[model samples]
Target: MNNIILSIIFFLMLSTIVFLIKSKKNISKLFLSILIFVGVLIGAGLLYLILMIFDNDTNISDTIKTMIPLIASMVAAASVVIATYNTVNGEKSSKNKTILEFIDITRDILEKGEITEKTTEILEQINSKLKSTDFKVDVLVNNGAREFFEFLNAVEGKEKIYILDRLEKCFYYEPGSPLDDLKKELIRKLKSNNIKDMRKLWVNINQLAGTPAKNYNILYEECSYSLTNQFIEKDLVNSKFYTDSLLKNDRKIVDGLLRKHFELKYEDIPIQYYEVYRVCNNILESNYEQIGHFFRTVHRTLKTINSYYERNSLEYREHIGMLRAQIPNQVALLMFYNAVYSEKGRGMARELLASNFFGDRDDFHFENNELLRSEHFLNNGRFLNNQDAHIAYELFTYNKESNKVYNELEKMEKKVVPVDDSETKLKEEIFTHYLFNKEKILLDKFIKEFHTVPRKFDEYKIFMNPKNNKK
Candidate 1:
């Protein structure tokens, strides 16, 4: 009877403490919970002692037997409370540590003047201290590369281009220069499928070669083509180097890749041209309003498409050829619209669009093709009759006014020599000489070099205040 009463008291005490702890809200509920369990066990032991005193026939063995369960419950509660506290504190500490580490790294990089040396030291420190975490390993490597290149550029000027050229001629280039040994080493690593090690070597070579230039494309092709092909094991249509080249806007690399990939066979499908075209079309379709870059790429693609059509070898002859003719101009207009609202690029945007529209291609202008006309050619709209004022406004800003200013100014600058056999011969000879000179010799370059792009009266008038008429 005494034992039963004690169990009831124990249960009530536990319930009351839990409710109190929960309601108070500021107490350490974990510790309170542990204390409640201990209090309940003590109550049970008091009840066992009371029963022994009341009965007098119950011995010490009976008292111990009753106390055993209470002792166990107290120990279990204490263990759980200690474990919960440790876990909560440990997690909080770990989260704080991670945040501090990232902040430290960002601050160190942002503060350093000699970023390359700093980054190199950072890598060594991470290896020695951070124990090489995968979460930021690649990011660290890429950051280090950027820092190193920026440092090199600051010190070397444009002569870094020549240094890279010479380096290429030394290490995996130049016959009998131990390149054979490196080849053997690479083959062994590749056979082992040591992708991590192979990537490291490629990274080292790229750093040693320095910043990407026209010549880097040639060296990358020579070094990685066969190996990358074997690594991919699927008739590699595009090299990793080519993808990197794309990100850098190195058109020279792009052109070389197109030529190389065009000849490779893939599972009864010639995939290179098609793949390149598809990626381009995806870029065009998705990001039409932001295609400042699509102009040059589209121009190259169209030239290739024309070549294919002329040979009658193009698989998607009609569609690709039509797209090639049309998409570049559309991209140009969209880019112009995106730029015009901005203060910085407005004039350049207008000038670029006008030049592209009026530049050569007499053939495309006269052709009565609806696709070409709708996509590229400019047309006047009847605003008053159709009440199409918005369309008229768009046409005015995009074409008529801009083109008029561009053409008038362009013609004003030129000394329009009358068409003569002697003058044409002189021009032809000048162009030939310019072509052989290996320097920029275009009309744009000539204008910039000489500071001679003539300004038209209309463009000049926009900025000037009109003279007041006498009343």
Candidate 2:
């Protein structure tokens, strides 16, 4: 009976130690103290047993000898249980303290209505702590998100941009954060059709990115001068005279002469054309850094969300759809132009196209001259005077017909074309020939049977056939 009781005690002690070691918890000072006391008792019990075994003169009986070790083992087991209880309760208290501290800090920042240097520091500290442990403060994080939105609603302009930058940091650091929802809200709030509002939006973006503000009049004058010169050089009549003529005079006099010449030669050019050109130049030349940063941030956020969900899942589609819906038609048009014209925005444009960010809406046009079809191509077949059309075309097409068209264009390029003809006209002729070539009559037949064709083919037919270019 005594040996059985001792065995049970020993088993309990061994189990407690094994469990504690496997749990990988830090051994607290109280636990260490108790363990030390239990060790001393065990040492004394062993000494007594040794004395009884070796010395015949020992007064301890067999039962007493057994009881000593048994008592020691029981005491050791009890100490372990008590130590574990204290350690667990202490951890609970510490965790509760940490949570409360985070709550307090968040509340203070919210009450201040602005994020200061100190606030950023505190947030960083908290982030570091949370990252180092398995602890999660989801409730606090969600509540903070709501409070942040409320605060964001109360701010505008630079302050709004500042807060958004901070908010992005918060979401970026927190794993599985509700960043997509935050981005959606930002898109809805920032999107605008009004030019003035859009300008203000870009200005704020520029400010955030530390880019200097652009002078609209100066940029407009430069664009007008450049466009007028191009027009003069491209003139079918008197092109040689204009190309040969040179002006050397005072700076202001030269500008005045160019202005007067532009007025006389392009009197029929609408103001909207100049306005579009000015806007494009402003975006591509003066403010691309800031605008690019804004779009890249948005793209990364969306990409992060995409990584979390299955591609074909309803959740992924719905989230992407919600973001796409927030972008108004005019805003999307601007984004399309920016993506198409700016070299830095090419990857973003491709991602936007693949994700169908432009949507399937057809009631939009670029500068009232080109019709956008199927959320991708320009319908009028004009190359827009640069590689813009080619870049856009390449991005939108990924099939055999497009490949065939490319090959045909390469072959056509080897043939002599008139020097007086603009590159836009030449490319347009190439596209027309590719569509109507006798050997590729199947493409034309496919276009005739549009209803039987795939949606992309239908889009392609609409793009290639000039008859479909209408409001």
Candidate 3:
């Protein structure tokens, strides 16, 4: 009889405590539950003992023994049921916390055009936790699918571009994610003639080399929408986008085609037509020393681009001429950045420059080492003070005058430039030539000679902004 009473008390106490801990219920409630169990157990025990003591029948002990077993079984079953219920509720609560946290992060991305490193760390933690369990991983993916569609319909302009880029990148770690579908859906929208700035779209699409998202057929179909034109020929090298896409294909055919083209050049196709193409060859095939030499001498390449710009009017309507005008500073800008910043593989960033158009590519590729360094370099964040290196070539290319380039560089070196007095004449004389070349050797030298240096991720929003692809 005593053992029966002790067993009932033990079950009640154990089950209540287990439920309280598992459910993470309030401590006060746990205490109250314990008190209730103990009071009931004591009362039941005392009553049973009293009944046994008063019994006078010869079969009383046997009857009491049977009653004790039946009561204990009922009590054990009830305690187990309570514990199971609490444990289930606890699991649901944990899942709810993950869902809410994911939603909050999605909202942050939508509102700020950025996310902090702390938030990224939190998301990583959540991702780790979710992967560690079978619960709620599908829930996040389902929610992501919903969010992806909603973003497709409602978002637009630069912000939409940014958000979509982040969406694909943020959930890249997720299995069976809808990002692949989301990209394909957006590409369909682009091809279906439902969106604006299709020209810009082609440029952005070409920048997607070295990515898992490379779907060349979708790109060709989209290109036919806006790019099948007088400026375009049925030939393989029709537009910069076509050339960039071709370079994206890695095969002996491209290499053989490159060899043949180099062997025989028809001058009708301007050097501008073949220069970037040739650079692409060097980019994909060059040895380390050869690449170093090319960067070291790239100022000469910039000069050739400047020469092309001088012969054509910036107002030229032919897409070829317009592309010609855009390529010079585009080359300088990308090459300078690829050389200076040590983020993405130099090869990756270099290849991206092949598809470069009017500098908006920076906004889309916010994470590239090149873009990251440019961000801080322009803002004078840590490495450089003269942002003129960022835009000096733009003015130089536009005006076809070395003086315009000289002026920006001169402005940057104010301690040396514009001093007409006799004391600084020699200093001005030396700095004069450095500031005013058709192709400034100084910038090229900076790129070629610059060794990969360490940078802090926290210094710019680029690193903390998540590994997003807004660039």
| Cα lDDT computed for each candidate against the true fold | 0.37, 0.40, 0.37
Find the 10 residues in a row with the least total lDDT in model 1.
455-464
**C-alpha TM-scores of all predictions:** 0.22, 0.24, 0.20
Per-residue lDDT of model 2, residues 1-471, tens digit only: 546755665676667765775675766667756765775576567556656665554444665677666666666665776677677768756644543444344334334533233333432333343232111122122222333334334445444455445445533423444545444434444433344433333222211211111221222321312222112212223222111111111122123322332233221211222232333444455544434544555455455434444443555456556655544443344455555444454444434433435442222233333334444344333213212333333332333443454345336545634444458777677655743452243223222322221111011110011233333
Model 2 weakest lDDT span, ten residues long: 454-463
Q: Please give the lDDT score at residue 127 for candidate 3.
A: 31
C-alpha lDDT of candidate 2 relative to the true structure: 0.40
Q: What is the overall TM-score of model 1 with all chains considered together?
A: 0.22
Q: Could you list the CA RMSD of all candidates, in the order they appear?
A: 32.2, 28.9, 32.5
lDDT, residue 91, model 1: 72
Clashing pairs in 1: none
Off by over 4 Å in 2: 1-282, 310-312, 360-471
Top candidate when judged by TM-score against the true structure: 2
lDDT of 3 by residue, 110-148 (tens): 345222332333333333432331222222222222333
